[model samples]
Target: MNKSTINLPENTIFEVLVTTTNNQKPHTKPFGMKIQDKQVVLTLFPNKTLNNIKNNKEFLIQFTLNPLIYTKASLNKLTSKDYQNNNILKEATVILRLKVNKIIEQKNNDKYGENIITTIFSTVTDIKQENIQVPAINRATTKIIELLVDYTRYNYMNSNQKTSYINKIIESENIIRKTGNKNHNKSLNLIKKELNIED
Candidate 1:
């Protein structure tokens, strides 16, 4: 999808189902896809998903609003029924079939602890939307994604960066308080506890 077609919040971590074929078999995993000038960008660390994409240049990104599905995918416990046609997720609100246009490999010494990383730019070949009504506000989803980002960076951050990330989490908590529902509160509380943050 292009910029005019898909509009997500600034710095929003878009959690989606990505299907890749490995050894003539399909594997579904969750990833954060960003939009950049008619291309979907994926900054991925070395893993099974990266290997699959390296072998097969085609994959599908499924946009879903089901938080449970996101959680399951993150935990690597996704069910077979979560996927349909072995390429798209049944719970997806929208689907985009993409082909890799560019793959840039880099090594990071600090941010990623000297790990090999791949940045993928894929073109949208097709789109399948299920008449999904766009929500005016997606604060809870944004907050959850932001909190997770902060949690992952907690150890790598320097003093200043650590403070900034903590401040961001506090801001997310305030937004959750103002706009989040029961599910949001539950997720926030669990994340806070997981990150060793006090109520």
Candidate 2:
């Protein structure tokens, strides 16, 4: 697998949904994932999900931009029934069902030094496209714009970089609008007004 496949887009944050079996129950949690060498790496605290992976050695990974799902999943507020017949999972643009092959534990030294032991491997088993289609409408586009704005502020980007980033954002919004998604058009208009761009 090419490592570049998992690389996160510049100024774009992805919501990673991980499905795991915990105590015979399926649980899903969203993480901010970064792609490296075709593998999705997530910094998970030693929690139930992490423990489930250590025990089961398998999981499902999905990528999505749905803001409502993203917010609910991240806060662990989603009910299992919500995913029962949802099109979101079925319509996921990218899905990876993987089996964990290894695990590497990290340790901290007494001298305040931390050892990074990565290379936990997982084999991808199934990948397919979903048939259900959802356009990048207003809510989605607005959420993306808000996310990019937050990322820029959090990363402390330079003024020139911010301008360039905003420009790219406008282009993305336009693409979504052209694809027959008017939701993003509002965001595009808002961004243009803010940037003082005519038409």
Candidate 3:
């Protein structure tokens, strides 16, 4: 997919299935996440997952690529799928089980809105690696980056600001390369080739 097309589905919410200590079951919530350094950074809105992490400091991250789930999540109408009895793989590519180490809450107010951004830092405890050959790229992340790029056209930004955003995308792609993600590698190479930056 091209940059615009690939980034089209971003900013829309996606299901983040997590296993928390408070519940003996796996809970699924819609979350907006960013891919940074091979780690999925989740920003919680002080909800169940946030509370659970605050209490026990550990959780699992399962990526659900279902379009229906994404649509529901975007509309803030997602219902938790009960995985208490039978653990079934509905729409997860790779499930990353993690233990929280730190939490950072930042107060910020922008022209668009005002809110507290909660950042959760966690370590991967176990990874249920999927055998699917396709590379797992967070579509939301790429779209968000593209949106930021588009937003820049209206706002006055210095050269550094423009470079910084592009660099973030490149860095994310680099992380995929370091992780040996085959699909990501192919996509990254394609992007490089398009930009004529391939060495």
TM-score leader: 1
lDDT of 2: 0.55
Give the top-scoring candidate (lDDT).
1
Candidate 1 clashing pairs, residues 3+ apart or interchain: none
The lowest-lDDT stretch of 10 consecutive residues in candidate 3 is 1-10
The CA-based lDDT of model 1 is what? 0.71
lDDT of 2 at 118: 37
Q: Please give the distance, in angstroms, between residue 134's alpha carbon in candidate 2 and its true position after superposition.
A: 7.0
Off by over 4 Å in 1: 1-15, 23-26, 150-199
Q: Which segments of candidate 2 are over 4 A away from where they belong?
A: 1-13, 85-91, 108-119, 131-199
Q: Estimate each model's TM-score.
A: 0.68, 0.52, 0.48
| Candidate 2 residue-wise lDDT, 2-71, digit = tens | 2223334543445577777767666776655555555655555456678778788878777654544443
Better of 1 and 3 by TM-score: 1
| Cα lDDT tens digits for candidate 1, 33-118 | 78877578898877788899888899878877655455455545566776667456777788778889999999877653677779
- Give the per-residue lDDT digits (tens) of candidate 3, residues 64-175: 5443433333323334462323333345556666767668899866543466769876666666644354655665435432433333332344567656645655666645
RMSD of each: 4.9, 9.5, 13.5
**Worst 10 contiguous positions by lDDT, candidate 1:** 1-10
